[model samples]
Target: MIDIDPNGTGLPGIDQLRVIVGAVMTVGLILAVLALIIAAIVWGFGANSSNPHLASRGKSGVLIACGAAIICGAAVTLTNFFWNVGQAI
Candidate 1:
């Protein structure tokens, strides 16, 4: 075990790790936003059209976005859970 100060005065590796996680999460969030925007646009434009295929495609896009969001949420939730368990160790 290593001593990690609450302030930035200890644990160099831990600090680097936190930076890496932040960058990864930021990119994930950007992707999530893009997915959601695409889903919304598809749905909105599809609603105004009479083509069933377009509507189906819109629904598919929405489903894909929902899936992406769920995966992201699950990953974060599981990570937090394991992190907390680790802290108890």
Candidate 2:
């Protein structure tokens, strides 16, 4: 019989890697928030100016920012989910 252990501490610098990844995710989320804010401002300005093209661009930007935030927040969960699915195969 063989056994496998998947403890995350098996390698050196893993803790550092975790720290870096955490920092990156934090930065990503912050950027997403900033983007959302900027996009909303653009949208409001465009609406006030009666510019359909600008408003459309701002709306797209808002959607993209929201999507980015969602992906950033779910990165770890998504990775784990895929990992488990792959393991089941």
Candidate 3:
């Protein structure tokens, strides 16, 4: 019988990949926050202008921005969760 190491994939640069992914996620989180702020400003303007169409679009933008933020914020957690799941397989 051969012994297998679960933690040994013999793959190189995994740490570097993790670092790159982390940096990308950080940038994405920053962009999502910016988008959320812009959406809020647009919502305020639409509300003040009393434009239903603009207001509706702004509302949708806010939802999307929030979703983006959530995804970006949870990226590391999600990645680790999936990684653990994979390892368990």
Candidate 4:
């Protein structure tokens, strides 16, 4: 049997790494939110102006923003899940 723990590593600044990652994720989520809002506005304007191409682009932006948010929010959980899966293999 083998066990691995991140904290077991006597490396300096490991705790700072966690804080940095958290801050990065927070920034990502904030950016995603801003993107979503801007995309929604673009979508509305396109629809109102009857510009199909613009509308399609706006729709894509909104979807991409949502995907970013999902990924950013679940980043830690997703990493842990994959790590466990890798360990089982």
Clashes of each: 0, 0, 0, 0
Summarize candidate 3's per-residue lDDT along 2-52 as a digit string, tens digits: 555445346788778778988998899889888888888888889999987
Model 2 pairs whose backbones collide: none
User: In candidate 4, what residue range of length 10 has the lowest lDDT sum?
Assistant: 1-10
Q: Which TM-score value belongs to model 1?
A: 0.60
- Whichever of 1 and 2 has more lDDT, that candidate is 2
* Per-residue alpha-carbon lDDT of candidate 1 for residues 1-89, written as tens digits (9 for 90 to 100): 78653466465688788789878877776787798788777777877877667767878887887787677657768877887897778
TM-score against truth, every candidate? 0.60, 0.92, 0.76, 0.92
8-88 per-residue lDDT for model 2 (tens digits): 988999999999999999999999999999999999899999999899889999999999999999999999999889777
Error of 2 at 18 (Å): 0.2
* Better candidate number, 3 or 4, judged by TM-score: 4
Tell me the RMSD of model 1 versus the true structure. 4.9
Instruction: Give Cα distance to truth, residue 27, candidate 3, Å.
Output: 0.6
User: Where does candidate 3 stray beyond 4 Å?
Assistant: 1-9, 82-89
Pairs in clash, predicted candidate 3? none
lDDT of 1: 0.76
Candidate 4 clashing pairs, residues 3+ apart or interchain: none
